[model samples]
Target: ESLNKLMKNLYSTHPHFVRCIIPNEFKQPGEVDAHLVLHQLQCNGVLEGIRICRKGFPNRLVHSEFKQ
Candidate 1:
C-alpha cells in the first residue's frame, strides 16, 4: 500500500525513463543482445512519453542531486 502510493507520487511527475541495457551475459565485452536491449526500451516510455527539450536536452540534475 505504501509502495503503491509512492509509485503514484513518482509517476505524477511525468518522469522520463532511461533503460540501461545489459547486452550479454557471456562475459563478453562487446557482445550485444539486440532482443533484450530492444525489449527494455519497447516496454518502457522510450517511444511513448519521453519529454525532450527544444535543444534536445533531456533533463537537468544538479551535482548534489545526482544519484549513483
Candidate 2:
C-alpha cells in the first residue's frame, strides 16, 4: 500500500517538473509509441541481444559523446 501510494504521488508530481511540452504534430504518435517500446526493451536488456544495435542516449548526454 505504501509503495502504491508513493508511485501514485510520483506520477502526480512528474508533470510539474517536466521542462517542455512537445507539439504532438511535430512528434508522430507511432514514433513516440515506438520509442516507449524501445526504452522498455532497453531496460529489459533485449536490445543488447539484437543483431543490429542502435546507440541510445538522452538528448543532453548526446552532446558529451560528441565532445570526446
Candidate 3:
C-alpha cells in the first residue's frame, strides 16, 4: 500500500535529480582533484545533460518571473 502511494505521488510530479560526486577518496577538507571530478561528471552524463538543456532552453525565465 505504501509503495503504491509513493509511486502514484512520484508519477504525478516532474522530478529533477541532484547528483553529488565526491571530489576525493581521502575525504579530506579543502582537497579537490580536477581529473577525478571531470571523470565522474563524464561518467554520470551531467556535462552532456547540461549541454542539451542549454541547447534546448537557454533562456527559460523572463525578468519578471526571475524577480519573484
Candidate 4:
C-alpha cells in the first residue's frame, strides 16, 4: 500500500513510463530480430512518443558479451 502510494505520488509529480522489449525468446546470444523489435516499438507507441516529444533520442547498443 505504501509502495503504491509512493508510485502514485511520483507519477503525479513527474510522470514516467518505461517499456522494455526483448529481441527474441530463444535466449540466443548475439541475435537480434528487427521485425520483433519494430513491432514492439509500434505496439508500445515509442515511435509515436518520439515524434510527440521531439526532444530526446532513441538509444541502442551492441553488447560485446551476452552469454546465453
Worst-scoring 10-residue span by lDDT in model 2:
14-23
My TM-score estimates for the predictions, one after another, are: 0.39, 0.27, 0.60, 0.54
Q: What tens digits encode model 4's per-residue C-alpha lDDT throughout 1-68?
A: 99999978875773447799888767577898888889999999988987866766533334653221
User: Backbone clashes in each candidate structure, one number apiece?
Assistant: 0, 0, 0, 0
lDDT of 1 by residue, 8-29 (tens): 9976885545667678767589
lDDT of 1 at 63: 72
> What TM-score does prediction 2 earn?
0.27
Model 4's alpha-carbon lDDT is 0.75
Model 2 misplacement above 4 A: 1-32, 52-68
lDDT of each: 0.69, 0.53, 0.82, 0.75
RMSD of each: 7.1, 16.9, 7.3, 9.3
Per-residue lDDT tens digits of candidate 2, residues 1-68? Answer: 99999979976762312123332435765445556566666766665645344454312336766555
Q: Give the winner by lDDT: 1 or 3.
A: 3
Best candidate according to lDDT: 3
Identify the runs in model 1 with alpha carbons over 4 angstroms from their true place: 1-17, 50-68
Model 1 RMSD vs true structure: 7.1
